[model samples]
Target: MKMASFSSYYGSLFLLSLFSSFITIALGGTFNTDFDNLFGEERVDIKDDGNSMTLTMDEYSGSGIVSKNEYLYGRFDMKIKLVPGNSAGTVTAYYLSSIGSQHDEIDIEFLGNLTGDPYLLSTNVYADGIGGREVQFYLWFDPTEDYHTYSIDWNPDRIIILVDNIPIRVMLNRQSIGVPFPTKRPMRVYTTLWNGDSWATRWGEVKLDLSNAPFVAGFKNFNANACIAKQGTSCKGFNGGKNKGLDIESKRKLQKILSKWVVYDYCADLRRYAHDGLPYECRKENLLQFE
Candidate 1:
């Protein structure tokens, strides 16, 4: 019995060390309590000593907020609880964007669903103002019931989108292969609750139900462990330092989600891009990396 106890104690220590290794390699971030109102001030509310905020969308207008600083690359996180019930036409979006005719962007848009339907999470990346890369998925959990962490890890090498720290989608940097990657510009984090009725639900088949008006979404715990553009190119304390690709465990989880929950991938739609052929990064080897 004594030997068994000793074994168990050492095993616990081993596990703790393993976890600490992961944490130590990444940069730490603090929760942001404030943001600049992008629009519809009356429809936005900040509470809990700026620790939390909510955005509302009514017939008159919707609301948005933008981070105070622009970041070039890093891990950005937001905990959000989506609008509830019959929210078919609304879209709650959290993304990063730079301004200009030729800009770069990374998006995480939640397309609202009917009372019992699942929400659709759509992700896309735009480089140099041209964007057609889109991949959509259905989450494993009911997003409206509670806050869930949605995160984006962007670096020079790749872009990873995660739900509760599990990567659901990843777009690797293929600039070498002639694929446009968002690398040069700096982006400000933005979150908004707005109506996208014309194409948000069933390709616009389902319009907004204003009867359930004043649709709202909750947000809190914003963290940006990034290289602020005003600072320098080197992100000294950014999480996912040095643009590491997925570790073995992360790759496994990504493969599982892609196989089970992915609803749409622009790369696989032959009809849409038959003339263009598949995108440069859509080759078999790239997809096999996670598998």
Candidate 2:
């Protein structure tokens, strides 16, 4: 009886420890307030003691910022409220990017719209300066009405983008098939409010109505649970290899969002890439087939 009881007690303790390990890996990293003005210094406002930031865009200039540290891999989250009414021709972009002519980038750009129209969310990935993997969506909720949590879960295996914690799109690592993934370079978080008037709204059909000038966007709760590039080449934990990939629940949410809200998926557009065969990422079933 004593032996059995001891075994049972130790078994329960072991199970508890295992569960706690997973939870720790899932939690976010530090709240990152390390950012500096990238451009239009006068138009950017930092409040809440640097925890929150707001960008203003007027006829004269727009504003932007960049993180002080660069990260190799991990999850990044920010709560943002997009430009309000009649935001046509304006774009509020939050993304991660590296420098140089052939740079790497992961984008989350809000293409403005007229009042009553949903803002178009454009996402793209660039590896070694070769981009064009564009996947666009129309969010189910009114982004301008309230702040929404946007996140990017990036690692060596995949890149998963989430809105309000729900996965919207995912790009898998397909380097074995000659597809480039943004693993070699480290990127810094960046946000910009600028005039993309020529092609932002309805492919330029709608111009920036300066009458509704002085567009503004709000940002707060910036978090970075990532492996800072400055901290040596190897590190363990979630920012490193601890994050294997999305679990079953996240994959299910990704599928639902892709089917319902996705307005444009480059993978399915035959006309755009008639010259070359479909990108290797699209040809493989593993890209979207979660089950």
Candidate 3:
């Protein structure tokens, strides 16, 4: 009887410890402020309140790449619900950069009016603004119909983009010169709605396209690592303009590689394509630059 009692006590303690270990493993167990849900810099509510004014389309101060002050990398996880609207516009959950070089922009755009079939998810990094491509995806169903966790783990060697804890896309952030140029920069977490007339919605009898000017959106859980490497600068420089420092031949080669995308149209397509892909193309384009 004594032996049985001792065994039971020890078993219980062991079980508790095991469970705690699992929890810690799940959370990465480090004291991370990026996961904080507190108000202010941590929890930025998108809705208009009595005190705080609503955010605008301009580069957001903290959320969007308001100039060069905001850039980042690391694991970005967002818990958000899409707002019900005309179902034709785009709501920016976050936008890192718009007009820049080196496929630097990272965007989380929500296309509401896509045939009401699936929600389009774009985790894209366009190079030189017009010359980059975006890896596109279509969710299992209407993400706006429910709340889902969207995330991207940007490591020095690669990037893993996940939707609802399911790894959807992965990219190898490697360069050909025997160097790895991981995406390390200040990124903005934007949540706004936009028009998607050229894209979104394929089978609707009455198409609800976003031909209008603006749209609305909401976001929860916006975070980044803001890691910047010294060598990464030269590689991500203004390799966009013609006759730039990056050999003209190299620039032409880039244009040919970038030709797969129809500029804005294809960028939207990648954003609206099924979840089976997205970051793969962006990563490919990014990788191509290095090659």
Candidate 4:
């Protein structure tokens, strides 16, 4: 028993070392309280459903949104359990924002749900990098029957994406843009379970299985610690920024809720951040101008 206890102790110490050269807690907790401001309590969640939700240009009201005003530099982490089915599209959960002409996005998308031992988990980014660009990586995991924590750490100069404390990809602050690096605005957080039908593939096929349409996914336990940019981070931000979901709402109610969204103007802060594709609809009643 003593030997077993000793092994556990040392194993934990090894993990704490992995977080930072300055950290010493030993095996950082999976999703702790320190990551709250960005994600909030019970931030990400998805529920299994027999309903089919498709968000077109007009009807778009799905998913929850968060802000990055709390902290300018810190980590954003979320733990999720995926919904299953052949119709299941790419599952996305990440933090990003667009204010002014600058845009930044990061994604952890499980592209396919083919029955198998290993599902394909991919990461993509866009920044002032090589092409101001699109870079991707593949991760194989048992997504059909397990929950995993998808995390990202953001410092002033760089951003790091992690899986179980394992750093998967990094984006540099000053990328290779012809001009200055692109992203400079404070971003918002968005988590979604979308069905990417236009380019969705199931066994080398792009067609979706309508019989099993509307697969469910859940996002819960978010940790967001945002600070101002004076401090720096070691991870990189990526491409893939947009909103996806189904809109099943009446016009009057849509206007009621969408008003909160328009209350804060992106025109001054951001040129554009997702405005078209959502599950909720907007009308004259939902329109409000901000000073």
Candidate 5:
């Protein structure tokens, strides 16, 4: 894959935003494999005439999918039904990442738990290969029972993770605080289900039960509105300009979720950052201001 330069990424975003002024783009639709152009077909099971895809994991192998086109910045959304029952050691990961050693990435990893325990939603961001910022939360609803919409809204200013349209977490651009933001590289959307027994459950306490092997995860309703940079030019139909920061209601929703369901936060993990205290962006004042 050819790596996109910082100037090209930002330039495409600017052009896409400008193009949106004269064109009205539709939103909220199904993703067709023919149009989306996905790779890693052999790694996943496709159904519904390619409208839906499933990833399965067993003792022998796991499955995954990746987008063929790279996107600069946009709102990426998908509906996923996670593995049910005692799913310890299983991890369903959906993320976007740039290629190379110093790549930038945004992640949404679902850590499986015992039947009655809630799934842990682990979120992290990496820029220029420096990423230890991990925040974990427990969903209010049973994730394995039904499909839920998970979305990532990434722009030049910030990144927001939403569940069913409600904001759950927000990571602002903290470049001034020495935090590297992902603005230079283009990333492709990817999803996979694999065994993560070593550190996936209770710090590896729960091991994978192969009796429950072939655990499956369903994915559909793939929706993305963002700037697509190809060959140093902005692709047409890139309509993500309208996506913006959180509103007052969204902030309230995020506050409610954090207060009730957030299990772990990098901002509060003093021990993990004992050597450097907390990152400047994770300071109490900065965190409170964002909240």
Candidate 6:
């Protein structure tokens, strides 16, 4: 397939404008305190007056929040501003996960970095209690500078991760190859700011600097429309409808981003797959076949 030039990708900025408008309508209204809910108070502080909410993490403890309801499959989007400055050893994570020992999960973790270095954006998937499919990337812009939209679009067929409307990663369902896809269980959207000093930065090479304690991450526009799953009942399908998938133009934009910004991809990591070969989708040369 022919790749898209950087100029072509830049020319398509209007699509992002359209996406932002669509999201505003889909989300219903501006973020307010009524939507602000907390899970852990001691570590998680909530100042929901009527607008957006901010979460902070310190040496003493970290904080997190969960959606009030669970979802099966659909699009989840959030505008987040990550922790700024010497945030080495900290992690700002957002993902979906089901309960139990054999639960399924999709992760988007921002691994903190030292000043002047880029944060490592890590993505992973877990199925039936097994997980190791890890991919990492460096974003095109400074995430801590401003809030950017990050989205996860999940369906039975595939999973797509988007940053500012540009596709960064795509994970196809490989159930045909005896691989497990997240279909049966319903998951709740969760976000957390934590101290992962042991392994968050360069595999622990950079330790957390407590002097920059109480790191803060801001969140807003938590807009998600999907099928709600209730306990003791079968999950309802996405009756509300699925989000738009990548079109040829969008794929072109993604190609440009990946070529210039992506630092690591599990599909191309020979060291990780040396012992057992690449995953089914990777070997099959699916959408994530950049390398």
* Candidate number achieving the greatest TM-score relative to the actual structure: 2
The clash count of every prediction, one per candidate, is 0, 0, 30, 43, 0, 0
TM-score of 5: 0.85
lDDT of 2 by residue, 197-274 (tens): 999999999999998989999998888777677533442333545445668887778878877899999988999879
Q: Against the unseen true structure, what C-alpha lDDT does each candidate score? A: 0.85, 0.84, 0.44, 0.43, 0.81, 0.77
Off by over 4 Å in 4: 1-64, 67-71, 99-101, 128-132, 175-183, 202-205, 228-291
What's the lDDT for candidate 3? 0.44
Error of 4 at 217 (Å): 0.7
Question: What does candidate 5's lDDT look like per residue over 1-291, in tens digits?
Answer: 235687788889999787766444334444444234243345577778666888888778777777756787788998999999999989999899998999999999999998898899999999999898888999988998899999988877778898999988888788876789988788888888988999999999999999987798999888877666566465333433444566788888988998998899888898898997888887766663553
TM-score of every prediction relative to native:
0.85, 0.86, 0.48, 0.50, 0.85, 0.81
Clashes by residue pair, model 6? none
Clashing pairs in 2: none
Clashing pairs in 1: none
- Give the lDDT of residue 216 in candidate 5: 89
Residue 246, model 5: lDDT of: 65
In angstroms, give how far residue 91 of model 4 lies from its true place. Answer: 3.5
Error of 2 at 274 (Å): 2.1
Clashing pairs in 5: none
True lDDT of residue 251, candidate 3: 44
lDDT string for model 6 (164-219, tens) is 87888887777887778898888888888888989999999999999998899988
- Candidate 2: where are CA atoms >4 Å away? 1-33, 235-243, 284-291
The alpha-carbon root-mean-square deviation between model 1 and the true structure, to one decimal in Å, is 6.8
Cα deviation at 248, candidate 2, in Å, is 2.6
lDDT of 3 by residue, 1-291 (tens): 999999999999998685444322122211132222222242243332211222222122222223222334445566666645455434444454533464455566665553344555666544334323445565655665565777756544455556675554444443554332434444434444433435544423334433432333345444443333233232232112211123455445434434542224342455565575543434445444321
